[model samples]
Target: MAKPGSSGDEQLPSNEERGCEGIRSRLPLTTLELFFVSVIFGMFSITLLCIYITMPSVDQKFLKIPRTVEELRTLTEYVSKYTDSYKPQVLAGFCVTYIFMQTFMIPGTIVMSLLAGSLFGIAEGAALVIFTATAGASSCYFLSKLIGRPLAMWLWPDKLRFFTREVAKRRDYLFNYMLFLRVTPTLPNTFINVCSPIVGVPYLTFLVATMLGLLPATFVTVRAGVALNTLRSFNELYDVKTVGALFVIGFVSIMPAIMSKFQSQDSDRSHSS
Candidate 1:
């Protein structure tokens, strides 16, 4: 029985304070949503661990700093020794590592891609890279759509604006535009993966573009891996000629959209005249 305006009443939080508490406590992802994401992420980790434990001679240093050429070579050698007996585990470990990096937007996928090429040969490696990359990108897309808007807004406000406008402008040719993004180093694949949904790109477009778009780059990285023994520096992976060729391919992918816009303008000019 509190009295009106008594000292006891003064100690109680006001409506405004209660409202502020509610706002502060609210989470972007509800508990259930977070739990679901955690479970999926955990499954990947568990799968990797199971593969590791079953391997007869697990290199504890496997996949440690894949970006380093020496470490990559060592990892390749370590895995090569057991390929005949542990091929499934090797492939599983690679997929888990690659997908985990992609799902959480971690770096070092480049190293994994290179390792794939070096260990598995070019064709198989490229297929694996493309498949895992697409899977990871799709996972990120849905996760971001569910609970990543605020983080994306916070991390990439300006880039978000540019991407949004570009996506809008290229709505008819969205797949080609996405292909351009994937093939070129224009916007990072991670950024595109997490933000594409936020910018209104369809999942199918993202999937198709990612699968086809990654082929050229995957071919290059895997080919570089085939020669991993001779590579002194990681820079050798993407030399001037390789980069120029990629840019050329990227430009060609988007050229149709550009040509369409130009033809549209030409029609408008003729009509005005």
Candidate 2:
């Protein structure tokens, strides 16, 4: 029953086999990966619970995460009442909550930054935001290092490949490139945080870039928080002018790298000639 020019044992896969393979490919993680995720989630939960238990008594309704300007104002008003008496508790809770959101790639950190401004003014608020953002980004980087390859590949195969290739081309100028990314909105921070370690970006470079690169944006958000009572919308925080300024800063950060790249090319041409 062997077909001409075919081995007797050779056969096309059945439809069921093909379907199973497709299903496996579509799965985002394996059992072990899920286990790792659960462990990290559990640790974060415990830390948050501890922070909550130590906090002073307050109406539970006012203790939710703020998603909008109005909601942020409400929570800020309520929390401000206690900051004087519970300064340490307030700072601890805020830092923990901010870090929690960042570590898990959650949104609403903008609102948290606003809250920092509302509570601590520009100087302290910017410092707090930068510190917590770096810590959170670092946490995400390490977590991704452990179990992010599959998830990143599944979610962003093209982006992952592109980032890896770009990083490869700029190993000598890695810090400048990274700082540019952080300063500009060229890529999502969450994507950068998760993919950096996967692409072999060292922790020091990631750490320093995150701290310094976040400064300008952090100052803008925190300053807006100072005028929280007059603030209308999130869009007001980042207009065209602000965005252009950020881009300019980002460009300046990478200028040295660009100049070096050009110099290297010229040197290569001279040698070839």
lDDT of 2 by residue, 29-106 (tens): 789989888898888889877877887676888767776789888998899998898898889888888888887889
Each candidate's TM vs. the true structure? 0.84, 0.88
lDDT score of residue 187 within candidate 1: 93
lDDT of 2 at 213: 97
- Which candidate wins on TM-score? 2
lDDT of 1: 0.80
Candidate 1 lDDT over residue span 169-224, tens digit each: 67778888999999988998989998888777889999999999999988988888
lDDT of each: 0.80, 0.84
Displacement of residue 71 (Cα, Å) in model 1 is 0.9
Q: After superposition, how far is residue 178 of candidate 2 from its true place, in Å?
A: 0.4
- Give candidate 2's whole-model lDDT: 0.84
